[model samples]
Target: MTGALTVRVLSGLTELSLTPPLARAIWGEDDGPEDPVLLQVLQRVGGLVAGALDPQGQVWAYLVGLPTARADTQHSHRLGVHPDVRRQGLGEQLKRFQQTWCLERDVTRVTWTFDPLLLANAHLNIHRLGAVAVAYLPNYYGAMAGINAGVPSDRFEVVWPLGGAHTHAPWPMGPAVDPLRDDLPADLPGALALCVPRDYYRLLREDPALALEWRQRSAPLFSRLFQAGHTLVDVDLSRGQYLFRRTAC
Candidate 1:
């Protein structure tokens, strides 16, 4: 963690092999690394496999993307940063690297899924990077292990347009709904705010039952709102709420 960090395109068996242990380090022992063989094949097929190396040439962060059905779109499958070196902006750095890589290949959009309750990720993907969260997939991955163990794998499918900044106001505002409460507003003229746990991981560790209750209670509400034509616009982390607005008809 001493010298300047350098992001580089990773290829071949040796460089690809470094990811499994790094994935374990970042996501816990239950985390399984993507197969190096498949990664090599992906590289051969115009996919991307890249990493951030520190002064010691250790992979501190890595990102993986694959070509999707649309030639101009890519699905970012995995991104991980070493726990000890987190909060140093490594995640964003890797994503900027991804942005340039995608642009070079004529890819106009990059898509990914993330846990909706994770505030830090919400801040990064929606606020900082300007990705749009469009769909709510409940139990998208079924049961999961590692840090995701014991939680239903609900995810927000986001699309990051590589062409320019994401659509939607950077800081949206309107009426708010506290999901912990049972009542939900029937009508709103402007954007709607939905509360999220400020520190979900801590809540999971300290009060697991409450964490599960929060997910179970919030899932259906999010689904209903999205079905009502609300598109997530921004996340107000300071207030612990996600901003959503009705899609223009």
Candidate 2:
């Protein structure tokens, strides 16, 4: 319509991420707060929100500054995808859009957190997307949701080299962001965290086949993040994902 998938800054009401139930479902994952999505809507939209939309209408995603932080240049933040639209390439487009946003604004770098145990994400962020992982927090969340059924609260802090691109397609994405600031900040812009329910660990401990799959799914990239030099900061207990940051040294 406009171009090869339009990119723009919007206020509210974009993509499945904005949908009330879907947002909550995604946040709850399998068992988060019944209204987790409400928090997603209020916080993400409360401030400036940006998104990317593809011609297929297959995806919707958003980015914004951390909620509690005063909102500044150095510690930029992001969250994305319409969840259902995931595994369809919309996530990649959203990431590219965020990259463009960071570059255009002269922001230093971007940061996010995820469950280190979630093998799927490990692949997406590390092996495929070119981000590196640092910090490993244990039980970051209190197993409040069903999704947290049997996994430890372990989470990884991942950072990407913004300002440039270093990805392949199909198996690899393109356009890695430029290397972030040459120097590190005394403190990062914001914090990253996640939690899974306690029961999920049962599946991992009992299902050798599934746990094998999880390991196979994530190992390659997890190792790569380590090679890339992202560093760990703080790790806690609970059960999902924690936070991480790119390191200067």
The most accurate candidate by TM-score is 1
What lDDT tens digits, residue by residue, belong to model 2 across residues 1-249? Answer: 233555555433435344334434455455332132443465464333455555764225544544334232323344555555556675565666666666565554556677665545555566556776665544556453444454444566666667566643231122221112122224423232322223234556578466444434444333443445544333323323323334566
* Clashing residue pair totals per candidate (backbone < 3 A): 0, 47
lDDT of 1 by residue, 80-122 (tens): 9998888899899889899999999899889999998999898
For model 2, what is the C-alpha lDDT against the true structure? 0.47
For residue 4, model 2's alpha carbon misses the true position, in angstroms, by 10
Residue 110 displacement in candidate 1 (angstroms): 0.5
* Runs of candidate 2 exceeding 4 Å displacement: 1-8, 13-17, 29-48, 51-83, 164-249
| TM-score, one value per model | 0.94, 0.51
lDDT of model number 1: 0.86
